[model samples]
Structure formats: structure tokens, C-alpha cells
Target: MAKAMRTTPLGGTRQLRRWHRARILQAIRAEAGISRLRLARKLDLSPSVVTEAVAELLAEGLLVEKPLPPTGQGRPSVALDLEGECHGVLAWEIDLDRMAVALLNLRGEVRARAVLPPAPDSLSAALEQLQAATAPHLSGVRVLAAGLSIPGLLEPAQGHLTLAPNLGWADLPLLERFRAALEALGLNKTLAVVENEANAAAYGLYALGSLALEHCVYLSLGVGVGSGVVVKRSVYHGARFHAGEVGHISLDPQGPPCRCGKRGCAEAFLSLRRWQEAPTLARLGEMAERLAQLSAVVLATLDPERVVLGGPLVEATGEALLRLIQAKLPRYALSVHAPEQVALSPLGREAALLGVGALAADFFMEQMAYEEVS
Candidate 1:
């Protein structure tokens, strides 16, 4: 048998630093072309601290100073924005029977994108196909990082997949594979991240300005139902990296079993796969009542800023799902009747992919800061 390759990411300490730096960059990224003074004010930090941070970032080429016009008035203010040309972060969305890749500049604006052939039977095969599809686009432009969103228990720290139910991926070194692939293409310098598809979608919603409410909840209705929590504009991955595994939250101990070894999870009750098994269950005329029970639990318990429902089925059912949730919600669910905030994601299909792009770009900027500071 071939010796098992070291699947885990090398340099553990570097990975930790990269994560810390990513968080810092996320904070500084809110404003467009922010001035040093303005950033300090917005972030409520001392001017000296801001200057130090900005100076280091500028040295790293992560940030560039926007030209300030000559105004023969008072002191001119210098604006800082992301340096897009420095590197690009790619986001891959691996869905059922389809593979999509998007190229985003360091500022998180999408530059270009294309779809790849859905041709693979195993993890290695899929990565190979993805590499082939991404080859032409990988020329010259520094694709220094990638964020992969797939349906599975993704071990981000290790850049490995604990399990991918839909695609039969298990214990695969997802990040390292991408790294190797990029290196093969002569684009060697980069970071690779694997995130749960649902959590990624929630973070995507936050980045896109749709789920603007600081305290928001996102429900990703897919082969399995997954939910995400955003408190104060950040995605909390939790201690065990399973914080938002809401699909496995037990709604009934006697109901169907979730892939994670739980029974009667919200997913079991509302999973699209479950509906597919028995088409009659999904027909609007028949299962309306069951969908209501399942949806209402999430709405009433979370009582979030808004309950956003996405994923293909949710998008297809659309407002009908919203109405069911509203009808089931107690008349006194919240103070004096603000119309039910249940909504289908307007961003639709591209939401998860864009979210991963934003996250990877943010990570790249953070690494630059650490490099400059060090």
C-alpha cells in the first residue's frame, strides 16, 4: 500500500496566526477607502495604534493610499483601500452535479468566474478536474488563496474533510490538495480553507448586506438543513468547530436519524433529501402543515433580527414558506407586530460562493498585516 501522505496543513503556528490576522482584517474592512483618522474613529482605537497598524499594512502591499487631490486648504486626508492587484482569492462552490469557481480581488469584489465540469467519483478525481478547469485562469494573476464551500464537516484548521455526505468525501486533505494543485499551476503562494457550506452561506449573507441585522440567523435548506448564527457581524465557529450545526439539533428523539448520529433533527424534519424520498411530502398541498411546524420552531426560538431561508428548495418554494412561518408564529411573537421578517435570500445561488470569496480575501489581507508587522 502507498504510504499515507501527511494530510494536515504544515506549520500549525502559522495557521493560528493566519486566523488571528483574518479577524483583524475583517474589522478594518467595513469602510470603503477609509482614512487613517476615520478608521481609528470607526474602530474606536487610539490614533497611534491605528497609524502603526496602517503603516505595517501599507508596507505589506495589502493596502494602498488613494491619491489625495491638491486642495490648497488645510491638511489633506489620505484614504486607504485594498490593493487588488497584489493577489486574488478564489472561491469554489461544489454543489450537486456542478462545480463553480469565482475570482475575487483582495477587496472582495468578484472579478471573474466560470463553471467547471462535474466529473468526479472520488475526492482526488474532483480536485483534479477542478485544477484542470481553473488552469487557464490561474496565469500571471496571483491567486494567493482559496476558500472552498462544500456540504460536509470541514476541518478548517487541518484543511481536511471529516466527511462529505453528498460527494462521498471522507478524511480528504481538501486544502493541501488545492495548494498542491495551485503549485502545479505555478501559482504556489497561497492559503486554502474549507468551510461548511451552510456557515459559509451565512457569512456570505453578512458580507452581502442582506442580513444586515447584527443579530441574525440563516437557514440553509439543502440535502440537509443547516443553520448559522451571526452575533455582532461575525461567524462563530464554536469550540469544536460545530457551533452552528443546527440541523442536528434534536426536535424529536424518535424521528429520522441525521448523518451526524442524531435523531429527529430539524434537518430530518425539513431536509430536501427527505422530501425527495417521498415527493408527496414536498407537494405544497400535502406537506404544508409539516413545513409550518418545522419552520416555526426556528423562528420562535431564535427570534433573530430576521430569519433568512435559502438553498434551492427554499428558493423554489419562496414566499409560500414565508407565509407558513408567519401564520404559525404567535401573534405576539414580537412587540406590536412588525411584519414577519421571514425572507428568501435575494442573492439566491451565488450567495455561498461570494461569501467564501469575501472570507478568503479577508484572510489574505490579514496575513499581509502580520507580515508587515513582523
Candidate 2:
């Protein structure tokens, strides 16, 4: 078993059912418009089992049977898809200076969104404000779950936020605090999850179809770095749910030291904080040599289909980074075609926020599927 932790009051049987439904929903989610036969095969479940689960999900308005388009062969097979408005997921995405809350439906549409000043470090006040921001849209929409995307590390299994390092908060009991907040708002939710900001952004990339390839590495160059990896269309959240912490990869053994107590991590070179610290680093062109050097190192190891460069600094110095990747990557990897491979994300600052919304909707849809099955 992979690090099991339950935050629900449901009995053992009910918890098993919930886990089963969530897996099924995730399989369907990986590929859109997949036939029932293929869905079962992908999940390695029996045809009867797939049919039963699909029937239950359809009843709960979580899955819809869509008409298959012509395939130039026999009659098109029936396909399964997520139904719009099946449920709503609320996201409270936190950053250094501000916070964003969004209510998203099952079909991944944003129905309502808001941004507010981040509450004081006290967890209670933050929860109260978020609950109120989310309450107005709850009627007629099933609220299956919500997720809190924080800038710092969260030990999701333990339900403990191991300090927002940038904000100087330490060892906060985040999940329990959130539970208290919801109870005060007259709400009993199915579940509330804690997701890393970069991981959420990576999830957003997939849920929105930015990736159409086998493997994608989502790299963020914000105040810090976070990586989200998609293997076979599902997130590979390592044994400890800490799979893609690529920002900490050491680039220079002798260079500046990271707050992680390590030297030469990518964030040490590419982050906005570093760029701002050096008044001479105002133009991307000035940092072109350094950005290219870092890009070459990242590309040589990951060789991702597209190296999504985004953050405040990526814009100011994108051209410079591209040039550096083009120059040093060829020298290191000996690949003549390396320059044009890395692509910047079309969805810049919005990437992380959008991901929070998607994960929330996914949590709700799967929860509903399990309830209907019971």
C-alpha cells in the first residue's frame, strides 16, 4: 500500500467504495471520449464492473454517455464524459501577497472567482473569509470537495503544513483548522485536500490539454520552483507525494546557497527574487548567459517535450533564456535540434490557480460517483 491516510468518518466499506470510484473517475479523466470497453481495459477491471460504475456515475450526473463521432468503420461506439454542473469544487490558492478563490464545475468551467488580500497568518481568519467567499455559490451545486494550494510544503498525509517558509509560518495544523472553519459555516464537505502550488499548476496543464505527448515536466520559475510530472496522463505523485521537486536540483556546487540549506538549486539562478536582488539584472538580455546555462542543465536531464518557462522573470528574460538554451544545450547534449524544442507556457500566472480549480472539481466528481454507487 502507498502511504494511506484517511480524513473521513466513513466506515471501512464506504472508504473502499470511495477509493474505487476515485480511481475509475481518474481513468476516465485521463482521456476524453473513451469507449466503455477501452475504459475498462485501461483500468484493468472487468466489463461488468466498468458498466456498473458507469451506471452509478451517470445517475449522479458525474458522467454522461456521449454520442461517438463517425470512425469510418462500424457504427461509432458510445463514449463516456464528465457532465457539466455535476458538482462544484472551490479552490483557495495562496501566494505571498494575495489569494484567489474559484468555484469550478465538473466540466472544468469557472463559474465564479475572487481575489482578496491574504488573511493574517492566523489560520482561523483565513478559513472564515474563504468559507464566506465560497458560500454564495453552493445552492443546487453539489460541493464534493475543496483544496488549499499553499506556497510552502504540506505533509498531506499528516495533514500538517510544514511551514510556509517564505511567510515564516511553521508546523501549522492546516487540515484540522479547515475542518473547524467549515463547521462554523454550516458546511459538512466530502473532503478537503492540500496540494502544492507547482503540482497544482502541473495538474492544470494536463486538465486543460496543454500536453498532448507521453511525458511532460511542468517547471515553474516564480518566487520558487515546483514541478508536476504526468506519466501516462496521470500525476506520478511519488511514494511521498513529493515526486517533482525539481527546483531544488543543484546546478552549481560552489554558487549561492538556497534556503533549503543547499547550494546551486535552479531557483537560486532563475527565480524572480534572485533577479530582483541584483539591480544589474534588470534586463533578460543581461542574464542571458546564466539562463541559457540553467536551461541546458534542465534540458539535458529531463528532455521534456516542452520546457514551460513561466514566472515574473520568464517574461522579462524569455528571449535571453531561449538563446542560452539554444547555445549551451547543443554543446552539452550534442543535439543539433535542441534549440526549438523548449516551449513557454501559454497560460502564465493563471496556471497554478487554474490547476487548483481542476483538482477541486475532480475531487467532487469522484466523491459523487461513490455516493451514487452506495
Candidate 3:
């Protein structure tokens, strides 16, 4: 006998049904080919409740049933799985060099993708480019939501982009613009989520469920250095949503000038753009020392379980840079925090794109739950 989920009188029935559907879908996703009885036990729901929710999901084309082999059973059991082909979400990464778009199925598999050159200086041109690139893929697929990853400061609650120095974009209503773009493509019902590139990568790593911990830091090294902090699988946007601008941390007041108009900032020393020429051992050592200082600050402040290094620069340097950072981490981190606490990102340049895809998937699930409730 399973314990029934408790409910209150205020919108309790609707909420309960929605919760049951979400849990059933989540459980099926976690354990593909799960049986209804096993799902009932896993979720601690009564058979009737699970059956009702599963029926609704099956009818919605969100889930499918496959007959399982039987051994000494009165009837064959059916395995449940997500209907990946029928629905999907969109992921977009807007970078200084290009705009990458991908369509991912319910299982997080990339069904189609495109990479286009950087958008024109005009905002309307950028939106038009996005729509044109995305419209062709929406022919046979139903898009539930979209996630946009930008290399800039974003106020997600307000749907505004405060700044993207590299792209010369500032103080724009980015989310509204993206929604309008989707509407132009005949996806008015699709929800849109906006996030910083680093933040999106951090959450994507967490959502991947393979290389992430409860608390981790993703250090994005590229033209400009940045980091995203994930606490309990969510981005820890600090007060004013500027928590992860570690690149601006000043190591010296009179050193080289940074793009942020500050002297002696970490970005001035550590940005990949600064080291384009062939690097000598001495130069690598210098970069290592500066990165060690930045890592020290991050470990001292966040004390995250892991510090993941990512970006074009990291990929270019390969294992050598990771080794250098690992060797230097000991000088700054505590003894308990081993050098192994630092690692290179396995997802590489596609990290932000994949992260935004995961975000879109989550948003789609939430939308489905709310739609069911209504």
C-alpha cells in the first residue's frame, strides 16, 4: 500500500493532478521503460492516481507505452517512455562571433542545428536573422519553449540585457524581442527564457546529470573571462544579478587596462585575446600565476565542489592549461580542496548551447504542467 499525496482545499485538486503528471513524466524520463506499477512505487502514489495521470499523458502524445516481456504473469506489463519525436525545444547562443541555434527533442538530443555569422549592428536585423534561421526547422516539430544564451549581463526577471561589451549591445528588452521573433515564426505559444552564457553553461552542466555536483563553478575563459556559480543545481544570481563577474576582480590598481575600463583587472591579464601570439613557457607560467590568484579568490568566496574551466582558450590550450591551473590551485585553495577539484569542461564550446537547450526543456515541462492545470 502506497501513501497518498496529501492535498489542501485551495486549488488542491488541480495542483495535485498537475504534480502527479509532472512526477510521472519526470520518473519516466529518469528511468526509461519504467512500468506503471514501478512508477507508482517509486513515486509512492496509489495505482489509481498513477493510472489517471499516465492515461492523460499518453493521450497528450507526451508519453508512449511499449509491451514488456512477461514471466509467470497474468498479463504483460507495459514500459513507459517519453515521446521524443512529437515535441522539442529550441536553444540559441548569441556570441560575439556567431549565432548558434539548435532544436533538441524531449530527450535532450539535438535533432537539427545551424550556425550563422554574427548579427548586424541593428537590433531588428538580429531578430530577423534569428527568425529566418529558426523558421525552417519548425515545419514538422512542435516547439514548446526556447532558451537564449547571450554573452552579457541579463536581468532575467525584467527580461532585459544590461550590457554585452563585446557585442556593443546594452540595455535592450532582449526577452521581449526574442518572443516577438518566435511569434513571427508562428510559435506564439512557445515560452522564452533568457540567461547569460556562462550561467546557461553552468546550469547545462548541472542538468547534464553526469559531471556536475550540488555546488560547482564554471569558469568561462574566452575573449573576456567570466564565471557562473551553481548552487544546488541553480545559478546563484547575487544581489543585482552581477554575482559572477569575476573577470573584473582587480589584482592590481595600476596594471594593464581591461575592457571594463578598469586597470589591473583579471580579464586584462587572463583573457584569451591577450595571449594570441605563440606562448613561451614564461608566458604560460605568468598566465598560470594570474589564474591561480583568480582561482584562489573563487575558492575562498564560493568554496564550490569543483571549478570547471571552459571556453575557446581552454580548448586551444588543451590539457596543458588544465594541468597548469591544477598545479597552481594548491597555492590558493585549502588542503581539503585538492588540485583535482579543478577540471576542464567536457562539453567544450557547445556547453552554452546545450545548457540553453536544457533550460528550454525545463521551461517546456513547466508550461505543460500549467496548461494541464488550466
- Give one digit per residue, the lDDT tens place, for model 3 in 120-223: 78667877887788888888788878889988888876789999888888989999998888888898878889889998888777876478576888989888
Off by over 4 Å in 3: 1-10, 369-374
lDDT of every model, 2 decimals: 0.66, 0.67, 0.81
Task: Give the 10-residue window scoring lowest on summed lDDT in candidate 2.
Answer: 1-10
Cα displacement (angstroms), candidate 1, residue 372, comes to 11
Best by TM-score: 3
Rank list by lDDT: 3, 2, 1
For model 2, the stretches where C-alpha displacement exceeds 4 angstroms are 1-55, 64-81, 231-265, 274-282, 286-288, 315-324, 332-337, 361-374
TM-score of each: 0.75, 0.73, 0.93
Model 3 weakest 10-residue run by lDDT: 1-10
> On residues 266-346, what C-alpha lDDT tens digit does candidate 2 reach at each position?
667667776777736344543555555555655666666655666556665666666655665555453643666665666
Q: How many residue pairs clash (N, CA or C atoms closer than 3 angstroms) in each of the candidate models, in the order given?
A: 0, 1, 0
| Alpha-carbon runs more than 4 Å astray in model 1 | 1-28, 43-61, 67-72, 117-119, 238-240, 248-282, 285-291, 299-303, 331-339, 366-374
Show the colliding residue pairs in model 2.
Answer: 292-324
Candidate closest to the true structure, highest lDDT: 3
- Candidate 1 minimal-lDDT segment of 10 residues: 1-10
lDDT of 1: 0.66
Higher-lDDT candidate of 1 and 3: 3
